[model samples]
Target: MDWVFLSELAINGALTGLLYSLFAIGLVLIYKASSVPNLAQGGLTMVGAYVVLALSHDAGLPLWLAIPLAAVIMFGLGFGIERVALRRLAGRPVIMILMLTLGLDIFLRGTTLAIWGGTSRSIELGVSYEPLFLGDLFISRIHLVGAGVAVALFVAFMLFFRTRTGIKLRAIADDYMASWSVGISVEHGVGLSWALASVVAVATGVIWGEIQGVDQALSLLLLKGLTVAVLGGLDSILGAIVAGIILGVIENVGAEFLDPLVGGGSRELIVAAVLILTVMIRPHGLFGRHDIERV
Candidate 1:
């Protein structure tokens, strides 16, 4: 445990956390609006990454163009899911809804596998860059770019929520019937939220693919995103952001400092432990509202 090593670990953790936030925030948005976690979130992220790889790497489209195209496709996918899948199950039991999303996750995974053939791919942004050297620590240009993009997106989303449509979405999240009475289309709001969530998923996919190669296993990586969302408080978008950063930092630091002593792969165990403790101690989550059951 050198102090310098600890400092580097902390920095790495923060970067990882920001990336986690990008994924988790989308989960929170969908959960807040629809009151059901989209289990397909992970698969959606994988699809986005594969779309980018296919368009940019295989098809020779520029990264800039391919990224946005993947986002648009994901947006359509989200809208389609809402219209064709989720809409049919509205007002269903929570368990039933969860199962529906699980089924969706399987479907999306199969679709990706069929199209992508389970091969790993990587993207080259083609930008020549150098690391930012800070005495004994070095931060890669790519991580810095990823963190900046994540923060910018987070701020932009906050601002968007201040608009009228954002207000309506929040209202729908609070009470669909009340929003409907006020002329807000609940279905539209749900569709919008899903679309927004899909965009976020695309952003996360791009960043993750840059950090690690695009692969079929990208969805499995979303277990981290799911953990961040649950720990942060499923309904709180800001909480997801904050918690994602915290989890990222903790995981990085733990893996760097504690791995030698405790053994590798324990970092994931730590995340799972934290999630369990947080859920048991605060069922609603760190920033989640407490549910009040009324008879």
Candidate 2:
């Protein structure tokens, strides 16, 4: 076994995992704020990418301008979903909430289809795809940039949680009834979470769009995000980061070694296996807090 090849795979996988974490963090944010694992995150990501594509490519706006605008637009869309739809189901059953998100996912996908159609479109985010060689190993410039962006945004969000609004959001997450008693608006807090999630989705979509083009298949990233969210604990941001890297490395290395033996498609299999194992062994995830309910 060549160690150089293994090292290369590991490095690339780690970078890919950071990207996955970026997407999965959106799910964590939603779950943390509302106890809802947003099933429509993938659709938001796909539509957000197309929105950026439209603004930059079709509308002739510069890439920088288009991205921020797309983020704002997606933010509003998310807020609307929570306020108009999710708000109506405030005390609904778990199954109903899940189904609502699933329905939202379908609605988002349909909207994308109606506007952008089903064809894939290449998007230019002004990131060069040139490979940077480090002695015997090489890495894509875009991947490095994307990973850096992910880390930076993650840090920024962590800091945001220190502000007044962030504190309110955190309080609401801790106990909705308690928060309301203290005059903290649970509705606004939850809506803000959805908006932020959509903003994060835009960033995830743009980075991925640059790598794979804007297409319907980009929505498949929802599964990757879901896998990471579950493995990391739906409400734990740090867990998402760690789980993403673990999954990323496993995907690259496992696929390389096991694909030939399994006749291919081991990448997805590895993800599924890890997810299953995490659910079975540690239902709350590596860093998730296990709830202790009073009878």
Candidate 3:
């Protein structure tokens, strides 16, 4: 009933959701293009963040330069991952693809652990840790910056999908065989999707590291993004966007109002319940299109 408190929670949660959308959008891109559930998304994100850390910290590069460097590295990583491990497995059973991605996730995580150690390290983006206040409502500067970057990138993506390259991407997403049949170069399109997805993952990783620092736990964001993807719809970018915002708001509200009553941890409990509820009520998700395959 307290308007100020409610408004604060809503805005902060929505900001968090905006960050979540970065990775979820990447997941949808992969699924749309390759029909593969990329379990390695979190691993890619973690690797991207570490690249940033290494460049900015160890190499003494500026944050600005390091971020783009991370993007480049992630793109190469994604493309090569597909080329070496995924390209040959195209059209394989879904379970096989899923297991491969799971293995990739493990491989990437192990590599990160070997390089970064187990300790959590600050991202040191050289940005002010100041909070922006609107009367009684306040938010962190990092969150605002991240939300702004996310919105700009999201708008750019909207435009990207309208270009010729995007058309090819969409064609591949809609139908792999049909795309190849039309000489669209399915392998090229899928490889591009992986590259682009990793770029997005890098952005998400940098923003997330700024907010939560860099650590092994960052890989767990894949689960959070996956939850957003599932709640929104595996193949729907808009669904991921909407679902991320909804889940973020619900999490903050539940934590504030229900945590005390439950003695603690009600926020996660509520989110897990929402996932189950969404599965029960709308198996295809709120905006997921139902596919009718007559087999």
Off by over 4 Å in 2: 293-295
Name the better of 1 and 2 by TM-score.
Answer: 2
- The best candidate by lDDT is 2
Best-to-worst order by TM-score is 2, 3, 1
Residue 96 error, candidate 3, Å: 1.3
Candidate 3 segments exceeding 4 Å error: 292-295
> What TM-score against the true fold does each predicted structure earn?
0.93, 0.96, 0.95
lDDT of 1: 0.82
Q: What local distance difference test score does each model get?
A: 0.82, 0.88, 0.85
Clashing pairs in 1: none
> Measured by TM-score, how close is model 1 to the native structure?
0.93
lDDT of 2 by residue, 186-242 (tens): 888889999999999999999999899888888889888888999988888888888
- The Cα error of candidate 3 at residue 63, in Å, is 0.9
State, as a TM-score between 0 and 1, how close model 2 is to the true structure. Answer: 0.96
Query: Tens digits of per-residue lDDT for model 1 on 68-92?
Result: 9989988998888889987877666
Which segments of model 1 are wrong by more than 4 Å? 127-130, 292-295
Q: Which consecutive 10 residues in model 2 have the weakest lDDT in total?
A: 86-95
